[model samples]
Target: MISMRHVVFMNVAEELSFSKASQLLFISQPAISKHIQLLEEQYQTKLFERKGLHIELTTAGKLLYERLQAVKEIEHKTEFDISVLHDAIQAKGNLKLGASTTVALYILPKVLSTFHSQYQQIDISVLNRNSESVKEALLAKQINLGIIEENSKVNQIQYTPFITDKVIAVCSSKSKLLKKKNYSIQDLPHLPIALREVGSGTLAVLKRALAKHKINFAQLNVKVRLGGTEALKNFLLESDSLGFLPKISIAKELKAGELKEVFIDGLALQRQFFFIERKGETSDLNKGFIKMAKSIYNL
Candidate 1:
């Protein structure tokens, strides 16, 4: 079994902030300091250097952190193994997961809830970010798994198809852009549009669809680039700016008539969402989670 001190230290190393690590671990700053001090004493080396608000790990600290990361993974796997040996139907352990904005808001809740119901003793935490952030979390080993809109081509990560979605062009009922029965991609150059930021799955699909219509995004009259789907939806509701978003992400708003899907000729944007993880690492917990996700999505 790994010590709590080691776990706490790993959290601190990952967060690079004592306060943030303490908050995440539900401990106080002083307690975090004590853990760090204990770890340093055991290693007989300084683990971190403090400079203003930022902290940097010493060489020894970096080495220790890398080992501790593997220790944490082994510790988690051992616990799950014990539970299985005991025939616990609900596989109980910590599951750290990340998801892009669209998947987090639309797809994950139902799937995670169902998994939790069967494994009531398991603790799950999810971080919501864009696809790039999700990829970062996986590479850092900060999250054990991730669900992302397929946008990147990172060679170190393995991606499996989780689900697919369609991008819908939407506008406020008050927006004049909806007046056109069939707007072509060429017509998009004339309207001010709101868009998801680069590296987002929605943006990736939209870019490809535009290329098919021979329209360069550089020429479009973009009003703003929003970070997340919710931000884009809120902006769309309050302004005349046309936006493209996942159809699943705006079901409620569209049902209530807060927004309407605008039709575009020669455009039917579809993209897959992928479950991603570091290549060559596997565990029963990770496999279980993937199985649950696949079953939930009926894939």
Candidate 2:
């Protein structure tokens, strides 16, 4: 169990305003201040720094926040386990899930539907964000599990390979770029490209692959940066710009003749989707879901 001061500090750290923390906790502003003061005195370090009307966590505070977040997750999991063991409630429990855009949009719908049908008692909530943001949410305990495609590894999180996905360069069927007998990877920089915005897992993979070929992202003529995969696909259908998307996502369009895959002689863009959770932390619910997903996807 965490102390009252620790809870107060977390609230203030998240909100970045003592008054907002007080309102969130339903405590007096002076009481919130006193609790933080006591914590600071005990630690013999300043936890926050004031910048005009805003407040930000100091180095020490940031460290404490990270540890405390883990503690909170453990506590939450403990309570959930106990409830599942004892309570005769109608609803089994809630599963908080976070996923990157690709997984959320292209992958999870059918899996989620099947899971819901099989386990109607379990309530599910999903938060969708970029891969980096999904990882951050998992670490902050805002989500119990995450599915992402980022290649960069974080020590605090453990990644289990979920599924293999490929990112391929694609264009509208009407694009003139298809007139060439063969497209070479070297020709990519001169073509008009539409890419996912920064922080996207697809974009990350594209950059790493390009770097291996001695190509910089700035060398590509990026005409637009879209935030969602669906939006990027729509943009491709309207314009002649080339874009990279998950093969699974564009299957329908490719079959319908609205889009065509642009093959570069030497370029093969592939990435793996991962089941992410905090290192050394696992719950029965998360384990069951991961198992079900693997079975459903035949992975």
Query: Best lDDT goes to which candidate?
Result: 2
Segments of candidate 2 deviating more than 4 angstroms: 1-10, 18-52, 55-68, 86-94, 118-123
Q: Give the alpha-carbon lDDT of every model.
A: 0.88, 0.90
Per-residue lDDT of 96-116 in model 1, one digit per residue for the tens? 999999989889999899888
Off by over 4 Å in 1: 15-42, 50-55
Expressed as tens digits, the lDDT of each residue in 63-91 for candidate 2 is 99989988886776666577667753433
Q: RMSD, each candidate, Å?
A: 2.5, 3.7
User: What is the TM-score (0 to 1) of candidate 1?
Assistant: 0.89
User: How many clashes (backbone atoms < 3 Å, residues ≥3 apart in a chain or on different chains) does model 2 have?
Assistant: 0
How many angstroms is residue 138 displaced in model 2 relative to the true structure, after the best TM-score fit? Answer: 2.8
Worst 10 contiguous positions by lDDT, candidate 1: 84-93
